[model samples]
Target: MAMHMAMEVDQADDPRLQAYTSIREKDLTSGHGARFIIEGKVTLETALRRGRFKLESLFLAASRLEPLADLLAEVPADVPVYVAPQDVMDTVVGFPMHRGVLACGIKGEIPFPANFLDADAKTGGPSTLLMLSGLSNHDNVGACFRNAAAFGADAVLMDGQCCDPLYRKAIRVSSGASLWLPYAHGGTGADMVHAAQAAGYEVWAMTPRAKAQTLGTLRVPEKLAILLGAEGPGLPDDLIAAATPVRIPMSSGFDSVNVATAGAITLAHVFGARESP
Candidate 1:
């Protein structure tokens, strides 16, 4: 591991740190230009390990240097890690995130969802994909990524209406799984279903509707695409009609779980079914 000396910063508005300025606002309203923020030591380290992103720079509290030095060695020599005192770091970002670490990562060109599905098809073996629709809540989005990773899903596909999984809180809530999971936003729920179908994946639309088959009956095909919708509205009826509709068996009158929890349960069942002799 190579150690690079860190640059010290005394001012909050240092032009070099411009990308991190008022970042909470950017976290809420906009995507940083061709870049996404990765915060926390673990998530930053995971991004480095995943090797899927180009790390632009790092901004860290001075105290983090010794702790993160070994991991920093793996970062390319060209990337600067800016070190600042705690208060200066707070002033620069206009908020205090106790995590004390942040990295700017360049977003690579997002390939179509079918591109990933195609890659899975080339294997001629079992493949699993998690699909999301209209999930605007960052926490739910993050939890979904976490569940997808836990169940061994190959990649995650989301409709445009879903929140960006790279949003800082989402990354944090995912505990860095978002950094490791392969994911992309496709067009819409129907578009995702078509993309999956075109790629030879059996599309299973998750719903609470009684007409849908209980998930207990599924054996999980060699290539499976499971679709989940936003909490309140669930999957659109037309989209559900298009795909094989499946529902988790719940209490008689009660309808649903949190979307993420629903994903976890379904994915767990699929994982177990796939493992069974």
Candidate 2:
């Protein structure tokens, strides 16, 4: 077991505890340089186990520390662990931290779409990638990450307009899947599709148009890139035209499904359709 040197803080403004103050505002305007906040026990525990992100510090309610002692033992001695009463934590964060667990972590490097896809191809296992465009809603982004992880997608590629998967609420909603999954952000929808194509992936754009190939009938490729768009606008027509347009068969009355829901169904189908050697 690793030894822990936990420090106790009585005041919210203590310089060492600054990372816990006005967290929501700081998260929006000034994300901690290379670091981000990890909230709730599950998310923090996963980060500890993965060791992908380096833990900068930990702030917890003193009452909750006893139950988490074993987990805390895994923290490196050089890292600081701070404990405060729940009331003090609530005040420091400008909100009630019901979970009473929070940690500061620095994100590790993430690969670009082409590099990620290429690496997967080299691994010899079939590759599945999810591509997102203009997905500005954090909830949708989080759900997509959860679904991608659940359905065994190798990585996610998002346009510059997509919300950060590491956002606090997003990480919580994904059950920390965002931190574990490989994802790349930047480029437009079209750019991502072309990049996937250049990496030897067949791109499939999800849409509701009548003429699009239904998910059940389209041939699944060995290395596939499933493209999704924002809630209402959907993928641009030009992007759809540039790739194999696909639609999930549904009752005729509904125009479309939620982006995340559609992604889940599509990922399940593609993952299920992989051919055995």
Candidate 3:
């Protein structure tokens, strides 16, 4: 009874209420210098279990203590666990009734561009890299990283225009897959393509435009960089012209597929092709 009472007291005074309430792209960017916020219980749990475990702290509604006892047990005792009312949790997050938990995890460091390219320059073999230019949606960016891992791609390179894969919504949508993926900031869309090619990656720009060659028909290289753009705009003509254009055949009238979906399919084919090479 005493322990329960203490828990309630702790809950009433929890300072994380302020932290949770302040969570947002800007708040995350300022508070801990965090580039991302891994919001909600399931996402936090998934991240913790994934071994990368970038969590800074955990927050839970006091009422949910009993239900999350097992999950909370595995967390290090030193880690701060704060409890609050469900209303407080929801109110802070600008939502209602999540799983009674959320965690703030630090974003991982991105790798250098050289790590993914220039095999002959002494670093390593031709590393597979993903380039996203003008890919604005966070969900798409997250999904792309998920597929990159599944396809065994070495790392991801997002140009200035792409969405941040570490954003809260993106991280949740990815089921925490984005946490471990190696990625680097690709400076500019045009410069990114040029740098990738200079590093010896055969850039294959994916587009569904009329004159595009089918991805199935193209010759896959030992070291390839697959480039994808936003859904509606597709790859800008300059970017497409800059890269070796490739396409995935679709039934007539379907026109095109989602950028992330198309990227996944292309990644799979590229992965298979690499195996034979």
Number of clashes in every candidate structure?
0, 0, 0
Lowest lDDT block of 10, candidate 3: 1-10
Candidate 2 global TM-score: 0.92
- Scored by Cα lDDT, where does model 2 land? 0.84
Using TM-score as the measure, name the better of candidate 1 and candidate 3. Answer: 1
Model 3 TM-score, all chains together: 0.83
Candidate 2 lDDT, tens digit per residue, 133-183?
999897999999999999999888998788788888788888899888888
User: Could you list the CA RMSD of all candidates, in the order they appear?
Assistant: 1.9, 2.2, 3.8
- The parts of candidate 2 lying over 4 Å away from their true place are 1-4, 28-32, 108-111, 115-123, 275-277
Q: What are the models' TM-scores?
A: 0.94, 0.92, 0.83
From the highest TM-score down, the ranking of the candidates is 1, 2, 3
Clash pairs (backbone) in predicted model 2: none
After TM-score superposition, the amount by which residue 124's alpha carbon in candidate 2 deviates from its true location, in angstroms, is: 3.2
**lDDT tens readout by residue for model 3, 253-273:** 887889889989999987887
How high is the CA lDDT of each candidate model? 0.86, 0.84, 0.72
lDDT of model 2, residue 262: 98
Clash pairs, candidate 1, are none
